[model samples]
Target: MPAASASSARSNSALSGSRCHDRLRTFHERLQSGWRMSAPLELFSYWRSSAAYRVRIGLNIKALAYVTHPVHLVRDGGEQHAAAYAQLNPQQLVPTLRHGAVVVPQSLAILEYLEEAFPDSARLLPAAPFERARVRALAQAIACDVHPLNNLRVMQLLEREWQRDAAQRLHWTQHWMQQGFAALELQLANALHTASFCHGDTPGLADCVLIPQLYNARRFEVDLAPYPTLQRIEQACLALPAFDAARPEMQIDAVV
Candidate 1:
């Protein structure tokens, strides 16, 4: 095998091992504890939506199997507005995870739900309360601060409602991404928790969120040269099977 192929095989093996461990832990929880860990899962998502991307990474990290319902955000005047999609997600968002009968909307909520629903999986958050709070804060800095201003609806409103052109929209996207990234860069540079990943050496919830935000940042041409720590962590994440498998381009509905 080529070097890249060998690396990929190793990553796949590690991912499989992680999933197997999670399964055993889940079984222990089921027998020793009262938590129901297994259920049919369905994720309604769009290929390019960064919010949806975060949930995908979380599910993959948990080693949970879920069906994908691709909602093409730009096709047919946006399918999310249709009554069928709205019934499942009142907000008509791209990432609504269905676990048997329980439906969950919002990417962060879905991440938290997966952690709670599959407690035995590779932990997305730390057990230490202070460490967990730090991770959550990092995740929110990107998901809440950076991503919200660049939503599809927000951009569309800027175009049609405010009569802005493509250049203006791009500027709007880049501006917010830079602003948020600057703060995140500072935190990561100075924080003691910063390691191979956002919170620690292993990939966790903050990583799940930050990687997607980086994808969007690149899309908008936000300069990332100043954030060496952030970029280093992202490279580490992209090497992992959990993160690579959940990339937007890897989705079934991804267009050329």
Candidate 2:
């Protein structure tokens, strides 16, 4: 898909509405009228992208059935650059969610929205405001701190502008992963909130973010020996079907 210009991207919602046949519109109205069945939540995602992985896990936890529209991030210098995808996401980020005419871009916002809009399904965040905030903080620790620093674009910049070799790139990745894990491990190890998962006995939003980031750590051969708490929690998470289903290698578009 060619990247859509910002103007075109903004029009995706309207365009989607126009493209919907009468039955589709009726179907959506039925959904809006509080029909409980899963709607066709079209997710534009790259299998290996951790931000995208977060949303995948959320969807699985909510038990929502959605079609995966794989957006190859590395192919042809990024299919996200294509006009079609850019139209769906003006920012050209992966893991954009399409619910009827609504196009949600940010992963965290998408997760929260799904939890709110589909409350009967397994809740991702806690009901208490403070607890929700804490879960969001823990999730942001990984999403905002560890992730953005080592994202593909940042790594690309290191190689392009700083002339970093593969070894340098791996070092860069591991440095950030270890730094974040060090803090997270201690935090989780001490916090009474930590049960088998990050938030409580049941897996929540924090665990969703942590597990994927840890997956990335292992992917780059980042040493996990320093983060025993993270490892223990991750092992518990992997035992669940939801987390296992959301693994990158299990995605429909996962590269073999």
RMSD of each: 15.3, 12.9
TM-score of each: 0.86, 0.86
**Model 2 stretches with alpha carbons more than 4 Å out:** 1-38
List, residue by residue over 1-256, the lDDT tens digit for candidate 2. Answer: 4456766876986787677776698888777846435457889999999999999889999999998999998899999999998888999989899987778998998998888778789999888898888899999999999999999999999999999999999999999999999989888896978889998999989988999999999889998998889999999999989989999999888987
Candidate 2: RMSD over Cα atoms? 12.9
Candidate whose lDDT is highest: 1
Kindly report which residue pairs in candidate 2 clash with one another. 1-82, 2-82, 2-83, 2-84, 3-81, 3-82, 3-83, 4-83
> In model 1, what lDDT does residue 6 have?
100
Candidate 1 segments whose C-alpha is farther than 4 A from its true place: 1-38
